[model samples]
Target: MASVKVMRMKLGSEGLDVSAQGLGCMSLTPYYDQPKPEPDRIALIHVAADLGVTYLDTSDIYDNHTNEMLIGKALKGGVRQKVEVATKFGVSFENGREVQGDPAYVRAACEASLKRLDIDCIDLYYQHRIDPRVPIEVTMGELKKLIEEGKIKYIGLCEASASTIRKAHAVHPITAVQLEWSLWARDGEAEIIPTCRELGIGIVAYSPLGRGFLSAGSKFSENPYEDYSVLSLPRFQPENSPDLVTAFKRVSRITQAKGCTPLQLALAWVHHQGNDVCLIPGTTQIENLIENIGALSVKLTPEEMVKLESIASADNVKCSRYISSRATGESSCTPPPSSWKAALKRIFFYG
Candidate 1:
């Protein structure tokens, strides 16, 4: 197969240039299923970098830091110079999963990520989840300090509300806002997307393929419970499985006419979102990664975009994206600094 040349885009008005299509490294871990061997995963990363898919995204919480360690090993021997590494902090699993954004925690997390990635500085550092107990301002304050100390080049936030994004951007220019945006996940479009555009902040779209549902379709329903990790999601539950199957069939029909796989069409839909938007579609297989990169070649007319939107509109997709009470979205808003201590107490006692 011929290597697809990836185009570049600026993440924000701050002038951080990265490949428009990035590699989400979560799947390289065991989040979806048992991870592939270390050699295979590392080779996938090298292939991604070689193909110009250089915006590699990972997080500290992914498989308890193993994902970052894997990336570190892959970037050895000067491969680091060819890619832009983006990893996130917050959302600790130390004691049954907690979201932390305290200034102290933020500083410590940045230091730990720096050490684990074996890099002097991270290209783009993001807070994986908003800490409702801590003010967005407080989190951004510490992240800004990291930038000054040369620990991270740019700042980003994931699953943050429009209000929280605006407040955080005030502390320092937020280069990107990472969110779950896909054909089925259009909740961000109603508010968060406009907010990012209004502030000139680029969007780093995670789970752009709807957690692989748009790709695998009804096949996920088969032995869904075999993988307890995904079974916990409402979208994959027995009650909603039929709806997902129906939706995928509709999307598959369009792909047939376009002469592309459902995965390519799904990713192409995201690619058509805008130049300011970058989508990270994760895959462990080399073929899938190549197919994802091939999305750049699949073009859609305006009418086709509208047709696809109607098929997987948020209303059409039943069940919430996640079952976690802490699942953040465009509506996620943090409390003020004055109530930070009180919120922490509630979380400790109730949760």
Candidate 2:
């Protein structure tokens, strides 16, 4: 395989530098599809690292912690030192699924992630989801303590609202805000992106390929109705799939004219958003990983970006980004701190 050195950029003003494109490890498990052999997945990670793709994104909730373990095993024998390991917490599975961002849970989750990744300090740690019951201050307070204790280097939040992000940053400078932003998912552009830019927080875009829809179009799933994950997403339903597929086809025609694949065009669109925006597009296959890296070379001119945007604008895209009732994007704000004294005590004792 030819070596490709991906460009690097600073995630936020906090001095953390990573590849402009990162490898999202969610699909390495059986979340989206059946799992590939462990060795093959590990080799994919190795190849990504050898190609200078060193930012690895994973979460504790993925496959009940198996995904982090896989990344841990892959990073053994000095590979860990070359990469920045970013894993998330806050989505709790105990006592049924729930989001936990209280000081105690935050500390416990970070400790568990550190143990699983087998790393003394995480390069970047994110709260996978916001817990509405907990104040943003309370969650950020615990993460601040983790930074002080050398457990985590930088802080990030996934699917956080603009207000939540600002409040969290007030508690401690948020290094990055991870949200689902792509040609089809433009909800964040209206507010979250500007807020992050205003606060000097970097943006990490997940699902930049529209959960594989932009890449495969109507063929995203051979059996869309039967695929549990695909069915769970409202956009992949029969009604919405046709319109989305039509928009994708129009975009595909443009990519063909640009001499690139639809996947590259989708990713390149996100990359063109700005230098502060980093994209983590996950893939289970080595060929797909290599293809994702190719997006780095597919530069888009201003006119090309505008033309692509017109084809798959948010208005043209169908259905909500997710079908779940979980807090997402602008809806991720949390309640205000009820009592500052009580919250501080928890931070003090927990810290």
For residues 1-351, write the lDDT of model 1, one tens digit per residue: 536689999999998999999999987987657988999999999989989999999988787788899999999998999999999988876666488999988998989988899999999999888888999999898898889999999999888889999999999999999988899888789799999999999999888888777777746645444543344454556666667777788898999899999999999999999999999999999999999988899999999999998988655686566542334432222233453355443322211
lDDT of 1 at 92: 77
TM-score of 2: 0.89
- Please identify model 1 stretches exceeding 4 Å from their true place: 95-97, 221-229, 324-351
Q: Cα miss at 73, model 2 (Å)?
A: 0.6
What tens digits encode model 2's per-residue C-alpha lDDT throughout 30-62?
A: 765688999999999998888878899998888
lDDT of each: 0.83, 0.82
**Candidate 2: segments with Cα more than 4 A from true spot:** 2-4, 218-229, 324-351
lDDT for 193 in candidate 1 is: 96
TM-score of every model?
A: 0.89, 0.89
